[model samples]
Target: MNWNDLERLFSPARLGRYSAARAGDTTKAALDYTYNLQLSEAMMPMLNVLEIALRNGIHTRLSALYGREDWWETWVADTNFNWQNKEVAYAKAKLNRRHEPQTPDKIIAELTFGFWSSLFNTQFQHVLWKDLRLVFTRCPKHQRKRHNISSALNQIRDLRNRVFHHEPLLWLTPTLIQQHSVGVMVINWLEPDLAVWLNTQDRLPTKWAEWNITSD
Candidate 1:
């Protein structure tokens, strides 16, 4: 079908970008929409690995630092962790609503990726970076600074949000590829063998190379 028909079915709001980007060429626009789906699909494995690994890394380190797996309880009560007060409350409230026990594992799984990434914020470096920074076991001593890991987590967080939201990512294939690598790089620092396994599950590298070559 043509752009007019596709737009009608999919809603102009949703297809407008593809239509404009393709200069009203229905075939090109459709192809681009399809490509976005394929790319986003290929992105899931990488994003999943990044989020899980980062969250678990934080949970493990913090649990040890505070001497409890349920460290959220401790942090929530401490005035120093004020930035996270609401998020911690929300996780607890939600668990209460769902009838799930506020276990450490459940709380970690419930926290948003934004919460995990925000732990790397510069403001918390003095209080948390010294300990949380140890999560990157394989990272070089010099390169294990807070800012470096924070920047990588922020990049991965942004890319993960975009891909999960179904945003178009083919326009900047090379740059997108570079951004996604931040996740892989962080994973490598955490566990080299896990990073190797991540590559096995990841289709992004191959898919991006193929699409970038043929995408006009």
Candidate 2:
């Protein structure tokens, strides 16, 4: 596509007002490279931590609740809990169609981040506060509220969606940093060792230091 056509396809307006301010000077190629780099350096690590914490946290709680690793089927069968049934249905379908038998761990690993994040919705408040509270036992005693966890998950989910869709992130540095903190906190809450490992794995700080971002 020509420059104008490319600009129309990846509109600066959709990237937010800050990006629009630099639209005149920034080329599409530069914007694409910057966003891809930002995702790899900043967003991906946070998303990795968040996804791991979420699945493991919920899995641990559910296992304890049902006294089995295969607690997902039991939980899905509970009519009282307001889970997104379609996700469960999809999982079941996949398992059924698989050539080999699939275990709960395999199924859980295959589930999407959306499925895990949905568990924090208000409909599952009972599960969050009563059944899953122990999952976050490492969280600060005062900040162990389910709502706080839910809020953090929601923010991280939004950031994830933005990054995956190639949306602008340079304008949301502060927000991204906050969400990254939330991801780390949740990871620490779920598994201290995992959190420590993540600290070493994370490269966002180094990437940010190297970028030296400036207005085009």
Highest TM-score model number: 1
Reference-based TM-score of each model: 0.92, 0.79
Candidate 2, residue 56: Cα displacement in angstroms equals 1.9
The residue ranges of model 1 lying beyond 4 angstroms of the native Cα positions read 172-174
lDDT (0 to 1) per candidate: 0.85, 0.70
Residue-level lDDT tens digits of model 2 in 107-167: 7877778887777777778665687778788888899877887887777788778878866
Which candidate ranks first by lDDT, i.e. highest?
1
Residue pairs that clash (backbone atoms under 3 angstroms), model 1: none
Give the true-structure RMSD of model 2: 3.5
lDDT of 1 by residue, 9-104 (tens): 889998988879878877878988887889899989988988898899988899999898887777766777776878878888999999999887
Please give the TM-score that candidate 2 achieves against the real structure: 0.79
